[model samples]
Target: MSGLEGCWSAPGQVRGKDATSVLRGEWHLGRRYFVLHLRSVAPAQAYEAAITYRAGEKPGGIGSFWMDTFGGLYEPSLGLGAVSPDGFYLDYHFPDAAYHNRFERRGKGWRWTIVERAPGKPDKLFARYELAPASCRGTTFTF
Candidate 1:
C-alpha cells in the first residue's frame, strides 16, 4: 500500500460542478488500516471524508469503512473491493443508491471516479478527480 501513502491534490468535478480536493493517505492501527482523508476546497460546500481500508477475507481483496459529511451518524457505509491492474474498485451500497468508485493511475497522476446507481434511474457520474502528487505542507485538513 506504499503507493497510496502520500499527499495528493485534485481538480475536477463533483456532481458536475467544478471542485478541488486535497487528500492524504496514512497507515494507522500499526499499519492494519490505511486511512484516507479528503477535503473539498471549492464549491463552498465544505465536503470532507475519511475512508479506512483494510485487508479483506480473500487475498488481495479490500474492505472499506467510509465516513463522510453526507453520511448519517448512525449509518454504516461499507464497501468491498479488489485490487486492480492500476489501482482498485469499491462498491458501496446505501439505502437509496449504490456507488461504484474507482481509483486508478493515469500517466503520472491518478484518477478517482464515483458513479452512482439508483432504482429507476441510469448510472450517473457523481464525482471524478484527477489527482497528482502534492506537498503536505500547510494543509488544514489532517487525520
Candidate 2:
C-alpha cells in the first residue's frame, strides 16, 4: 500500500480541474493510518473532506474514518474494506444507505469506483475516481 502515498489527479485534470478533485494524503498516528484530504470545486459548489485509513488486525480487512463538508450529511462514517488478489473492496453502510466501492490497480496508477444500492435494487454508480501519480510524497504516507 506504500504505492498509495502521494498526490493524485483525476482524469482530465492535467489542465487544472478543481471540479474534478485532487487528492493528497500522508500517514498519521504513528503509521496506523493514512490521513487523506480531498478538495473539489465547481462553478456553484465546492466540497472538501478528509479520510483516515488503517489496516485492520487481519490480512483481509481494513477500516476507515471519514468526515466531509456536508452538514450532517455523512458526519463521520466508519467504513470497512476487504482485500483480494486483484484489488480491494470497501463497503460503507450507513442507516438507510449502502455503498460498495472498489480500488483496483491499473498499471502504475489506480482505479476507484463506487456504487449505491437500495434494498432489492440494482447498484447505481455514484462516482468513479481514476487516480494517477502527481508527485512523490517523501517516502510513504507515514507519519
Candidate 3:
C-alpha cells in the first residue's frame, strides 16, 4: 500500500546518458484515498507536482506540473506508474510529447530505460544508478 506519500529519494543518477531525478513528498491518507505533493531535484533544477491515489489493490495513477530550462511551464500532465514484484514502469504524457519507461531494481539501486516518442522518431535512453544516501530527515508526513 505504499504510494507516493513517503519522502523518497533516488540516490543514484546517470550523467548525460540518463536523466536523474530525486523526489520528496508530503502525503495524506484519507479514509479511502491518498494525496501527495512531491518535489523533484537535480543538479541545478527543481520542480513540484501533486499526485493522488486511492485505496486499492494496485498503485494508482499520477498528475504532475513542472518547469523546464526553456522558461516554459507544463501543467495538466497525466501519468501512471506501477511497480511489479520484480519490475516497474512509469509513463508520462504532455501536450507534445509522451514517454514510456521501464526499470528493474539492481543491487543497491535501479537501472532505467526510457523511450521518448514524439511527433517524429522515437528515441531510446538508458541510465543506471546505485542508491545514494538521502537526507529526507523530518520531511515525511501523513494525515
Candidate 4:
C-alpha cells in the first residue's frame, strides 16, 4: 500500500464523454491502514466515494470497506473487499444494483474497473478508471 500513498488522476471518457477522476490515498491510524478518497470532476456532475484499507485481518489478510454516494442518493450499498497479491476486489449488493470492482496497480498506474450486473441480465461495463500520477501537479491532481 505504501507504493500507492499519493494522489493519482484518471482523465478519460465515460459513455463516450470526457470525464475526470482523482484518487487520493493516505495512511491512517499511525500507518496501520489507509483511507482513499475518490472524487470525480465533470461538467455539472459530481461523484465521491471512500475506501478504507486495514492491513492483516489475519496473518496475511488485507480487508477493505467501501461506501459511495449511491447511498446518499437514496440507496445504501455498503460493500466489502478482499485483496490478493495482484490487486483488490470489491462487491456490493443493493436493492436495485449489483456492482463488482477490481483495482490493480500495474507498473506505474492503477487499473480500476467496475462492472454492473442486473437481475436477469448480463454483466455490463460500468466504467474503467485508469489512474496515474498526474505530472502537472507533481504526481497529484489539483481540485
Candidate 5:
C-alpha cells in the first residue's frame, strides 16, 4: 500500500456535481492497516471519510471499513475487494444499494471511480476522480 502513502488532490465530479478532493494515506496500527483520509475541498457541504483497509480472509484480498460524514445511515460501510496489478477494486453491498469502486494507477497518478446500483434503477455513476501527487501542507484534515 506504499503506493498510496502520500497526499493526493483532484478536481472531479461527485454525485454529478463539481468537487475537489484531497486525500491523505498512511499506515497505522503497527502497519497492519492502511488508512485513507479524504476531504472534499469544494462545495459548501463537504464530504469527508476515513477508510481502513487490511488483508482480507483470502490471499491478496482486501477488507475495508468505511466511516464518513453520512455516518453509514444510508449506505453500506463495509467493503470486500481484491488487489489488482495496478490498484484494487471494492464492492459494497447493502439491502437497498450496491457500489463498485475502483482505484487504479494512471500514468504517474491514480484514478478512482465509483458506480452505484440500486434496486429497480439503472446503474449510475457516483464519482470519478483523477488524482495526482500533492503537497500535504494546508490539507484541511489531520491524520
Candidate 6:
C-alpha cells in the first residue's frame, strides 16, 4: 500500500486468436480497487471491469479475476511468501494455471514477471514485463 499505489493505464494487445486491444487501469492501495478496461480495436466494442480485493490476515487475499469480455472468473491472490531484495511477491491464478508474480521497479517503469507453477510440479513458467513510466514504476522496499 506504499509504493505502487495509483491509477495506471497502458496500450497493450492480448496474445490470442481473438486478439483484443486493452487499456489496463489499476487503482492501488487506497480502497483496494483494481480494474482492467478493454476495447476491441477491430470495432467499437468496449467493456469496463472492476475488481475488488478483499482484505484478510492471510499471506494472500483469496479472490477471483473476472474479465469484461466473457465474465471468466480467475483466482487471484496477494500473498507474502515472496521475499527478495528486488520486490514483493504475489500469485495470480486462473482456471487452467497458477502464476507466481514478482512486482519489481526499474528506472521510470516497473518490470512485472510471472512464473507458472502447478500444484505438484516445480514453478518454471516465466513471463516478463517492462512497464512504461505512465504505469506503476518504482522500487520495492523489503523488511
- Candidate 5: C-alpha lDDT: 0.87
Predicted structure with the largest lDDT when compared to the true one: 1
Per-residue C-alpha lDDT of model 5 across residues 1-143, encoded as one tens digit per residue: 77889999977898998888899999998999999899988668678888889999999999998788887574438899999999998988877788898999998789999999998999999999998999998886743
By lDDT rank, best first, the candidates go 1, 5, 4, 2, 3, 6
* Model 2 RMSD in angstroms: 4.9
Clashing pairs in 3: none
Model 2 lDDT, residue 107, Cα: 93
**Best of the two (1, 5) by lDDT:** 1
lDDT of 6 at 91: 63
lDDT of 6 at 127: 50
Q: What digit string (tens of lDDT, one per residue) describes model 6 on residues 73-136?
A: 4423333343346655656666556777666776655565668877777777465545554433
lDDT of each: 0.88, 0.71, 0.48, 0.72, 0.87, 0.46
Which of 1 and 2 is the better model by TM-score? Answer: 1
State how far residue 75 of model 3 sits from its true place (Å): 2.0
- Residue 108 of model 4 has an lDDT of 89
Off by over 4 Å in 6: 5-70, 73-85, 94-96, 119-122, 135-143
Q: Distance from true position, residue 46, model 1, in Å?
A: 0.6
Off by over 4 Å in 2: 12-19, 41-43, 136-143
Q: How far is 120's C-alpha from truth in model 6 (Å)?
A: 5.4
In candidate 5, how many Å is residue 28 off?
0.1
| Runs off by more than 4 Å, candidate 4 | 13-16, 56-62, 73-76, 135-143
- What's model 4's lDDT at 18? 65
User: Considering lDDT, which of the candidate structures 2 and 3 is the better prediction for this target?
Assistant: 2
Of the two candidates 3 and 4, the one with more favorable TM-score, higher being better, is 4
lDDT of 2: 0.71
